[model samples]
Target: MRAVGIAVFLGLLAGAWSQVASPVLRPDCDALEVEEAALVAQDYMNSQLTHGYKYALNQIDEVKTIPRPDGGENYVVEMDLLETKCHVLDPTPVANCTVRPRQETKVEADCDVVLSKVGGVLSVVAYKCKSEPESAEDVCLGCPQLVPLNDTSALQLVDASLGRFNRVLDNDTARFALLEVDRLATKPLAGTPQYLAEYAIIETNCTNDDDDNCVPLASPVARKGFCVAAGTPAFTAAVDCALFTNEVAPVDPTLNGTGPVAPPVVPKLQTTHGLKHHHRLSSVNVPAATGLLSESEESQEVVPVVKRQAPMDTLLELPVVPAVPLPPAAAPVLQLCPGRKRHF
Candidate 1:
C-alpha cells in the first residue's frame, strides 16, 4: 500500500512537470493572414465608400498583431486613404461615374481589422474605417476628466488616464492625431502617483505643411509626456491646464527626475534622415562690411547675402555649438603658515 501511494505521487509530479515544460501553441499569423484581414477591411471600406463616397486604395503603412483576451489575435493594418469623393456616382464604368473635381476632396481614414479563430477557423471579428472629418469642437466629446491621482483607485487609474489621452488625440482639432499608445507606465513622483505615457502622433492637416491660407496651427511636436492626475472635468480645458501645469520630468523616476523626456525616438523616425540643409545667396544685395554704402557702389558691387532657405517640407538644421569643457577643479592648497598645521 505505501509503494502504491508513492508511485501515484510521483506520477502526478511528472504530469505537472510535463505541463510546465511543454510550450503552449499559440495561433501564428503571417503576411497571408494579414492579407486576409486586409480583404475584410477593403470590403468594409467599399461599403462605406459606395453611392456618394469614393476612395482609392493606398499602400499599407503598418500591420500589427494584437493578442486578444480569448486566445485570438487582431491584425491592425494602417493604410493610406488617398482621396475620397462626396458626390453620387453612376453604376456604369464609362458613364457619369466620374465624380466632379469640385465635389471630390483628399482625405485620410484609419482602419482596424480584427481577426479571431474559433475551433481552428479564422474569421474577421470586427472591421471599421473612420475618416478624419473637418475640425469641429464637438469631436472631443467624452474626454476623460482629470482627478487627483491619489483619489482614484489603482485598479482603474491606468485605464482612466489612457482613455483620456486617447480621446484628446482622436479629436480633429488636435495638432497631432494620436496613432498608438506605445508605452504607458506609472511611477511615483515625490510620493505622488504619476503616469508616463509614450504615444505616436501623426501630422494631420491642421499641423501639416500646407498653404499659407490654411489655419495657423501648432507643430505636431513631442509624443511623450509626464502626466499627473490633476485637473477639472472639461476635456479641452483640462488638457490645456495640464499641459501648462503638469511636471515635465523623466519617464522613469528611478533615473532621477532630471529633465524632460526626449522625443521622436521611434524606429521609423530614427531610420529616416531629414532633408539636407542648403545654403543659398539671397536675391537682395547689401553693403559689405561698411555700415553705409553709396547708391552707385551698391549697384556696382552687390554683396550677395548668404541666407538659409527652409522649405515647408524640408527639415531645418540648426547649427550645433560644441559644448565648452569646464576647467578641472584647482588642487586643494594646504597652508601651514597662515593657520594651524594640518595633522596627517
Candidate 2:
C-alpha cells in the first residue's frame, strides 16, 4: 500500500511522494514524517565511536523482513541513509611514502536518501557496493579490485542507539553489510534526546574497512578525511569539516587504500641530529626519536580557507531522494537519481 493516502498526501507533504526510492528523496519528506523519520533515520547511523567508521547507516530497504514485536507479522520495507565521513591528513610526502595518522569521527544524520513507508513507517534499503565486473576473458574475478577504506552513512550514532546490531557484517574485509535498523530501537526515533542516545549505541558497530571489531584510538585518530572526540555526537559534527585528526595516506590504491596499521599509534618524530642533515634525511621523514609535527603553519593555513566546508550549506543542499509508489504490475525494484531530484 502507498505510505500516505492521496487525500492526506497534499496536506501532509510539500509535494507528491515520489514513486521510486532514490538519493533525491532524502530531504523531501513531509514535516511530520521528516521528524519521525529523522528519529528512526538516526538510529540506523549507530554511534561511530567504537567502530572507527565515520558513519554507520542502513535503511528500511535492507530490512528483508522485519520481525516486529508489537505483533501481526513481519513488515517489508526499504530503508537507507547517506553518511559523509571526512578525516584530516598532513598530505606531505616523505621519501617513498606519505602518512596521515588515523582519527575517527561519526555523526547522526537524515538527509536525501530513500526512506520508503511500510505500514505507516518510513525506512530504506541498505547500501551495497556492486563488485566490479570482469572483462570477457576473466570469468573467475570475484570482488571489486578496490574498496573504499572509509565507510559512511547519514546517522551513525542513531544506529548505535539500538542495543547491539551487526549493521555491517563479513567481519573480515572492507565489505559493506547493510542490515535492518528500526528493529533495534525501543522508542520512536524523532527529534528526541533518547533517540540520539540510542543511535550512538549502534554507531559503535561500524568500521572503516569491514572490521568493526578493532580497538578504538585514544582522543585523536583519523582516516580518510576526518576525526572524532572518542565519544558520540558530542565528539564531532558533520559541519565542522576542518576539525580532524591526522589520517594516513593509502599505500597502493589498487590494494584498496588500506594499510597494515588500522590506526598508527605514533606518527612522525624529530631526531636532534636529523635537522642538520636535511639533505641526508628523507624528504618529509620525522626522526622516530624526536616524535612530532607536520603541515607547517603556512601550509595548515590553507585548510581554513579552502577545506573549511559549509556545514549549514550542506544541510539543505540536496532535495529528498524520491520514493514513488510502485506501478500496479511493474517490478518493485527502485532506482537512484542524483540532481534530477527523481529516479525510476
Candidate 3:
C-alpha cells in the first residue's frame, strides 16, 4: 500500500509539471484585443517623453502571451514607431496625428511593452524603447545622440557653453538669458566627453554686470532667438545663434486692475567655469527657431498695424481752394473731408 501511494504521488507531480510546461498560444497581432493592449503601451511610452515630436504607432511586430494560474494573461508586445508632426503636448490626439515624412527630421524607435490582463481589464506592466534619428544609422563613434533634457552633465556643459557665448559676444546693450533647452546630447568618448545642445534665449533686463540678477523681457521690443552650442574637451565651445524681435507688446500683469504680479524667474545656475555672464544682443533679424519650439510654444501671428489719427487741435486748417493753382492736366487733386485733415 505504501509503494502504491508513493507511485500515485509521483504520477500526480509529473502531470502538474506537464500542465505548467504546456505551450502558450501566441496572440494574433491583428486581433482587436491585442491591438488595444499594444496601444496602451504605446500611449504610456509617449507620455514619458518630455521633448521633441511624439511617436506614432507604425506597426505591431509581435505579440506573445503567457497564461497565469489566476486566469490572468501576460502580454509581451514589440512595435515600431515613427515621429509624428504633432508635438507631445499638442491638443491633437495621437491617433489623429500624421507621421513625419522621411525627408524631414524623422526619428524612429523600436519598443517592447509588457502588459497584464486580469478580470477583463488590461494594464501596462512596463515598457522600454530604443530611438534614433532616421539618418543616423551609421552614427559616428563620438557624435551627438539624443538625450534627456534633465541630463546633469549635459546641462552643465550647456551652462558652460552659455558662459563662453556671453564672454565672446561684443555687444553691451543687452544680455541674453536662457529661455529653454530644446534638445541636448552628450558624446562619452575616451579622453573627455563632448556636449551638443540646441536652445532658445531672450534678451533680459539685466545689464552685463556679473552681480546683477536679471529677468527676461516679454515686450515686443524684447529680442528672442535660438542657439546651437557644441562643447569640446579642450574647454572650447562653438555657438551659432539667430535673433528676432517679437511682434507682440509686453504683457501687463496689472492691466485687469489686479495688483501687479511678479513674473516667473529662472534661477541662475553656477558652473565650474567661472566665466562672467554677459551676452551682447545681436542685431540680425531672423525667424524664431520653429524646430526648437516645444508643444507649448506656437508661432506668433502678425498683428495688424492700426493708423492713429492726429488730435483735432494739432490739425492745420487749409483753405478749400489751393494756394497756387496749376494746370488742370498736371495738378494733383487735394480733397479734404471735414473732420479728416490730411497731414503731409
Task: Please report the candidate that would top lDDT against the real structure.
Answer: 3
lDDT agreement with native, every candidate: 0.34, 0.26, 0.56
Q: How accurate is candidate 3 locally (lDDT)?
A: 0.56
For candidate 2, give the lDDT of residue 111: 26
Candidate 2 — which residues are off by over 4 angstroms? 1-41, 48-76, 85-344
Model 2, residue 270: distance off in Å is 36
lDDT of 3 by residue, 1-344 (tens): 44544444445445445444533445567667777887776665655553444677777766666675688887766666777755444446688888855543356666656577898767665555556555556455455665666767767767777666666762556778887676666766566777777676778886666544878887556777667777763464687766754643224444764444442221111111111211111111113312111122122212112224334432323223333332233233332211111110
Model 1: residues >4 Å from true position, as ranges?
A: 1-32, 48-51, 66-73, 84-104, 117-122, 133-344
RMSD values for the candidates in order, in angstroms, are 34.8, 27.4, 33.1
Error of 3 at 227 (Å): 13
Clashing pairs in 3: 219-250
Backbone clash count for every predicted candidate, in the order shown = 0, 84, 1
Output the worst ten-in-a-row residue range by lDDT, candidate 1.
269-278
| Model 3 clashing-pair count | 1
Candidate 1: tens digits of C-alpha lDDT, residues 1-344: 44544444445445545433332222223345554565555543443331223344444544545444576654534443333322212122212233212111223444434445444445444443445432334223332222222332431443444345545533433343433332222344455445433223333354333342333223434332323233222221122101212223325333566555542121110111112211111111122312111122111221222233434232223233354443454455432211111110
- C-alpha TM-scores of all predictions: 0.24, 0.19, 0.41
User: Candidate 3 has what TM-score?
Assistant: 0.41
Error of 3 at 249 (Å): 32
Candidate that beats the other on lDDT, 1 or 3, i.e. the better one: 3
